[model samples]
Target: MTKENMEEGVNQKNVESTQMKEEKKIDEEDTKEAEKVNLTKVTTFEELLEVVGTRGKWNVLTFLMCILVAFTSPLQTLSYQFLGATPDHWCQVTPLLEANWTHQQILDLAIPFSNSTGRPENCYMRDYDYTAAAALGYQTTMKDPSAVLRNSSSLIQCSVREFNLSQYISTVVTEWDLVCERRVLYSTTQAVMQGGKLFGFVLFAYLVDALGRRPVVLVCSAISIIAGFLAAASPNIEFYIVLKFIIAAVDAGQYLGIFVFVMETCASKYRAGAGTLIVIPWAVGYMVVPGIAYVIRPWKLLQVAYTVPALYTIIYFWLLPESPRWLIDQGRYQEAFKVISWVAKVNRKPLPADQVVLAAMENIYHQKAQGKEADSATKTFTSRLLNLLKQLLSLLLISELRVRTIIVFFCWFSASMVYYGIALNATNLSTDPYLYIFLGGLLEVPSYLLLWPALIYIGRKKSLVALYLFCGLCIFSVMGLMLTYPGEAEVAKVFFSQIGKMAVTAAFQLAWMYTAELFPTKFRSLAVGQASFCARIGSTSSPYINDLLGPYTVWAPSALFGSVSLVSAALAVLLPETRHCDLPESNDFFTKTKEAGAEGREQGVVDQDEGVLNPSFVSEAGETGSQIHPRKSDTH
Candidate 1:
């Protein structure tokens, strides 16, 4: 080797070393700048909340006010069972009625027995009437009308319909003639309302996030009130559909605005209890709705009766305050300060200095900006879809997150399916629909009563498994007793179905918090929200499951529902115990982020470069359940 050639190689190596040093220096500067912006945000809202106090006088007052107004959602929603209820109807038989045949006599001579139901056919009946027999004075209160009408009469379609208005003065079914083959329209009303709710939850949330919670809530409340009134005055089915759709759609605001406000205002420590308390009013409203309908009788009057209470919320416009976090985000720092200061003053706590409030707000703003930057990278519809798909794939493909995602999804799907399915089956549960509904509401109290302690002591996993298994067992009992014992066990079947409702209702409520806990903060909201699509599918098909499958067998819907609950419980075994574990640090913890520093390390969460939970992160999980194995080091 020549000295010159060896020297040239040495020079090449020295130059490469220098370039590496310079690049390292530049990277350090960028890292430092990011730290300054992010680490400085350690003064979070929770810290500021400590000084202002969480469960102070102001918080309690706000909680009570919110609770009072909580009636709007349940009343408007649950009352539909009776208002849109289909009544008992049959052929009109005007000829016999005009000819002085009794209503029962006309029904006996005109309507034919159904081979399937073994009761008189609602849609089809004997073509012949008892007009001639009535005129001849052969059949009376003392004589049977069936003896007068020939048994060989051919069946024909009734041009007109008659309804038994003894139970209800009028319902949508009677008014619209939605009996027989046209009954699908009755189910459609419910579907359309549910569809509206589905659409509204998504749309209203976006608007609330963008427009401030108070205004969106006010608008929703006002619209809901107006829509409720207009529903009573609806001239036709089309008008009723549109109005009810609006009512259902706007109800999302009631959920998001009022409930969310109450949640945000209360101390984080009391969240589980607060949620349980809020539901107490809702259950009460549901219980009372049947009584109102029973007394009002007329569907239109029932509509007004159900709607009158929400009118009290007209006071919310003056009383409701904007969320301090939202105020901080909007850069309305002074307003935020004033609101918190007022809270502090009312609670008799020391007021926060403006600097402390501003500093906290600044930290929050920077943190939110970091989140925005992550989200802004994918702005278009296609990009968003691709991102969601990628996140979903990560959840399924990744080893640690996969089981939790699958289990959570099934929990959501089955809970919604069975919960709503049971609620909607009230009318069919007994001869008295009111009793089924009242008992449903009644049982909810105990179920929700059991929820807080069960979650606190039993843990999320065990509580869910026990509740679901018990529920499935009850449903299976209902199916077996109905198929086996039939009439003698009628009361027993209703009892079991009602108990099943209780278990699923608790499970349904528990899923909301459990799903959030299973995921990390990065994608927690997305994970929680996406699961609703499955829930939506479950809820939407529940009515149809009961309606479509009933003729073939009474147990078909319960069979499907019970099996789903059991399967969901079984899937839960694979989920890791999150009771003592922290939420996942990042959506895709496998993809380590160069920017993650003390914050990520502190939470024991691996940093990722995404917005939503790779699974989804729950900021604060209310209660916890069992997990198979938990380690002190596990972040999520």
Candidate 2:
């Protein structure tokens, strides 16, 4: 070994050692930078969720507020069944004749009894002068004793003079002369209210976005109470109908506003399941309506009774908290922090020290500042409304979302139509209407209970598809029984119909969950509002559709509802399975071509540490490709 060769070897070893040391120092610096990035990037509200215990005092309080607010929906909507109830009615006998004749004799003389049903035909009456007949010597007998009727006397529809409502103590149907030729008007009133609801949903969504959710509910509750009280004292059917529309419009806002607030405030882990349970109060409300109606019986008093509860909900204004998400979205960080602090205190959770929380909030403020900004120029109400509409329409032009949006809209429409159609028809049954409605509402509880586990286990798409098809089949079977056995199958028909109602109830809940999962955050509220609008349209038409087709044949509307549902079940198959999948956050996150292939993949991993990923987690790497995945909040 020469001296030069040994020196060369040592120099190379020294150089290698220096390079290794430099690399180690660089690696340590990178590690520290990564830690800093994570500490500052508090992208999701879920991180602070633990500090305010997930299910504790805050959640319990929120649940009560949500349930209380929801009770008005079924009360206002279904109370019409009792308010507009029609008992056996006939044409009013003139006062001149009634002075001498008994009630049975007056009815026997004026109304033409059907040999088939042994009851007077509701519309037709003998065109004889009952007053003149009584003036001369007349007495109604078991046989056709009237000389005018003994000869072939023609029948005529009742004039607008008056209606006999002796059988009914009181009902809007008889009071408004909404029987015989005007029977269709009774159903029309319900449809009009539903139309009002459709408009209200669109209007209130904007109000909620511009204002806060809490204030909108408070204002709506006040409006509903006033409208309802006035409606009970309506001078005529037209006035009552208009008031119903107004009450329905205001109540619709209350229903959805509280729903959004509840979803936003609930813990992320429990959100998907919690939404299913929210309908429990709505079901209970329906159940209570029948009992109230049975006790009150009269239409005017029943309406007043239903309206009184809205006054009770007014107290919730103090109890309900403004949604924390809305506060943060509006750049009110201090208010949001205060709410979080309150939640933590009520839950008895160990929150970080004041400095720690303040530091974390500071990070949140900075992150929000760096993110997207609402345009200052577009701050006006009109501009915001236009912007919201534009964003909603943009969803149609988006890639993968376009198909999903349309499909979900149809599913929502079908679900709502079938649900309300069945509900309204149950009132027309020959059996006890109140008991029937109560039983129907009772079934809703088990449906939601069954849906919870199904959503968690069998997955969303399969569960929805199964529910749609099962309900559709049950509905069609009821139609068949009405055609096949007609008389003997009454009990079986009702049983299957209730089953169908239960199935559709589950499908309706699943539809909301499925649609919410499909849209990105930017258009989530708009998308949901649009879907609800579509649903309202279907529900609006439901009463008239049932009524119009019912006279022709019960099977017509039944087949129509069943076929649409079956088609919806087929459509559900086309939707990408979203079980455990992250919700999308932006329009750009979706691919140009739809990925039906993705549905075949495992439901995807739910990272407890990071929270659920956006639906487009794998495709759009732009916003999501940063250090951490975006946290999927149920509010969006």
Per-residue alpha-carbon lDDT of candidate 2 for residues 442-501, written as tens digits (9 for 90 to 100): 999999899987876666778889999999999999888878875456678789888999
Which pairs, if any, clash in model 2? 582-615, 583-615
Model 1 Cα lDDT, one tens digit per residue, 1-636 = 899999999999999999999989876774454334322334345445656777788988888888776566667766667887766778887666777767677666667777656667787777444555656553452265555555566787775788888756789878888766777777767766766676676566556655767888889889989999989988888899888788887876566656555645555456556666777777888789788887788888888888888898888799888878567766688888888878877886654345755677777555444433344677789998887566545557666566667778778889988887888785445546788888888889889888887765556677788889988999988888867875456688788999999999888877766665566444444455555545666776777787767655777888898999999888765654444333343443323222233345433343221121222222445221111222334321
Ten residues in sequence with the least summed lDDT for candidate 2: 592-601
Q: Candidates' lDDT values, in order?
A: 0.68, 0.73
Worst 10 residues of 1 by lDDT: 608-617
Could you give the C-alpha RMSD of every candidate to the true structure, in order shown?
A: 17.8, 14.4
